[model samples]
Target: MGSSRQCFQRFLEQKNIVTNLLGKLEENTGVYYLPTGSIAFLAFCLIFGYGASLLCNLIGFIYPAYASIKAIESPNKDDDTIWLTYWVVYSIFGLAEFFSDIFLFWFPFYYAGKCAFLLWCMLPVACNGSQILYHCPIHPIFLRQQASMDSLVTDLSGQALDTAASLTREATKAGMTHLQKNK
Candidate 1:
């Protein structure tokens, strides 16, 4: 048994497969330096195995709730705006997830997939969820609407100014004629 276990370990190390897999998992979950055969790893496995729903609830409900309350109390305009935008985008994501679940729930690794997606969305690193949604869709739409509104305002203001100038010229001519008649 000992010899076979040693051989398996050697094979895993030689291929570097286990190490790479663990590294990727740690990168996504933010749980690093957890040895595979250690008690902590076993505990993590057990908790996640049975308490995945609970974990999802905490992440989905607790964090957002806390962040929203904190955002309201925050004095920094930029920070508040960032938090509010996150919530708006996240809400849209939630709606998409709801529709996706009808098909995705049939998969064996649905929960794991969902957790990975949520992590990607929330992670502050490059190509993260919030950044993708904001830059790809939300920001562009806002920019287009703002540009259209600005053009409309400019056109309306120009027309108003021209009308005012025409009225002023007519009023001045009438005043001069009245003065001449009085003389």
Candidate 2:
């Protein structure tokens, strides 16, 4: 039991490390994106939950579970308990989707569509949180990428210009030498 607990702790640490990397990457990129786990949770909920919710007549409950997992597993708080929670939430997504499908008219399309849309809307609000609390951390990374790309283009243009100038100089020198010889 203790070993199991230790193993769980390791899992939590791994999840947090990933979350931290994701947060850094998000900050580096301009577009605010969800962490991989949240994205996974959302996908599982939508893909799995849609069907489960319908089959089990539990769409309403499952939808909330999916949303809650994403909300609760923020970048700052990463641990084994939360990681386990994510898996539990994902399991719920599967069951919920399965149940939802059985009951709902649509098997996958409309039901999944609703959940996806709901998640899509949440991202902007997530990004808008104050920097001190929940700012879109990936914005800086994006800016840096843009700056780097721009600089790379500028360098390419400079090189092209140099090549053209060098060609022109060589052609002019050759022409002048030929004329002098002819004269």
Candidate 3:
């Protein structure tokens, strides 16, 4: 905890991040975007995303949207490998849930596996739920990339870190006299 806080303080002092653009809204307005209300859960809800992930799985039940992926041939295959991979991973996750339902029948073995799978499937959504709230106009299904909390923090905080790094480095170096001595 101390180290993490120290790092954050370093982040602040070094200004490796600029503004807290976390809540700042971009000016783009379009159908692809979700409102801010949904993203805020990112600041708090890791469990909620599991429910969202379950919903994500439901999206599979839909006749797979024949999304015309860019740089890929059209009508190449309605059921592309990418979609197949998604289905496979999610199915394993769903199977975990299914097994869990019958877990009571098997006690520790089924329950343990079920719990593990349930967590595996749901944790990403709950932790990274913020990404769901922000729809880039280009992502295939908005929040469909199976992003996790680390990825979300990177997406959310990476920009700030970049901005802060530049600003902080320049600020710290502004008073450097070694270069002046050489001159």
lDDT of 3 by residue, 1-183 (tens): 999567545543442112123213333433223333443453223233434434434334432332214214556663354444434555654575677655543343333333334334322233322222222322455356547756987887989999999998887787576677778
- Write one digit per residue (lDDT tens) for candidate 1, span 1-183: 999578546644553434566667778878655434443443454345667655654555555566567668878676566556667677787788788868865676555656556655655345667778888998888788998889999999999999999999999999999999999
lDDT of 2 at 84: 40
lDDT of each: 0.66, 0.53, 0.43
**If the candidates were sorted by their TM-score against the true structure, best first, what order would they fall in?**
1, 3, 2
State which candidate has the highest TM-score: 1
Q: Candidate 1, 112: how far from true, in Å? A: 2.1
**Cα distance off (Å), candidate 3, residue 123:** 15
TM-scores of the candidates are 0.46, 0.23, 0.26
Give RMSD (Å) of candidate 2 vs. truth. 20.2
User: How many clashes show up in model 1?
Assistant: 0
